[model samples]
Target: MNRTDLTAVVADATGLTTHQAAEAVAATLAGIARGMAEEGSVALPGFGTFERRARAARTGRNPQTGEPIEIAASVAPAFKPAAALRRQVAAGRPAEN
Candidate 1:
């Protein structure tokens, strides 16, 4: 779901107003972004980890013209789900601890 839907869920779950929940969600996302930018990673127990990963420069083909092109190296954000989350998704429900 999108931000609004997520905000609604947060509000319902936490007994907060929609506006408060929205702010909370925005702040949480901003914190995660800042953490990734400054420290290169953030880990949340029982949820997942967000990290910056390096991508090496590589050659690629232009789709439109089939011409060769150089792709510059860059750092990209990535996520790896915790084992609990992975198991929950695999089981199609919350997994028993």
Candidate 2:
């Protein structure tokens, strides 16, 4: 769901004002992103862990030109689901701690 829907759901469930819920959600997301970028990872219990991984530089061929191209190494974000989350998904059930 989009941010608006998420805000509504949170507000309804927590009895908070929509504005407050929206701000809380936004801030939470910002914190997670900032943590991952600054610390290279963040683990959320019963949810998942986000980690930064490096891609090695390599030579690739361009499909259109059929020419070799140099692909620069880069850092990328990766996510590993927590055991609980993985189990929930595997069983097609609602996620729960």
Candidate 3:
């Protein structure tokens, strides 16, 4: 679901106002971004781990022209689900530790 829907759910679950839930969600997203930027990773137990992965420079063919092009290296963010999360998804059940 989108942020608004998620905020509403959080508000209902926590008995928080909509504004407060929105702030909480926004703060949580900002914190995750900050952690990824500063430390290159963040791990939430029983959920998943987010990390920065480096991509190597390589040559790629230009699809239209069939010409070789140089691709610059870059770092990209990635996520790996924890075993519990994976299992829950696979089993179609709620996540558990």
Best by TM-score: 1
As for candidate 2, its clashing pairs are none
Q: lDDT at 66 for candidate 2? A: 92
Instruction: Score candidate 1 by lDDT.
Output: 0.95
lDDT of 3: 0.93
> lDDT values of the candidates?
0.95, 0.92, 0.93
RMSD of each: 1.8, 1.5, 1.5
In terms of lDDT, the best-performing candidate is 1
lDDT of 2 at 21: 100
Ranking by TM-score: 1, 3, 2
| lDDT of candidate 1 over 1-97, digit per residue (tens) | 7999999988998999999999999999999999999999999999999999999999999999999999999999999999989989988994454
Q: Which digits, one per residue and each the tens of the lDDT, describe model 3 over residues 1-97?
A: 7999999988998999999999999999999888999999999998999988999999999999999999999999999999989999999996542
Q: Against the correct fold, how does model 2 do in TM-score?
A: 0.87
Models sorted by lDDT, best on top:
1, 3, 2
Per-model TM-score, in order, reads: 0.93, 0.87, 0.91
> Which regions of candidate 1 are displaced past 4 Å?
94-97
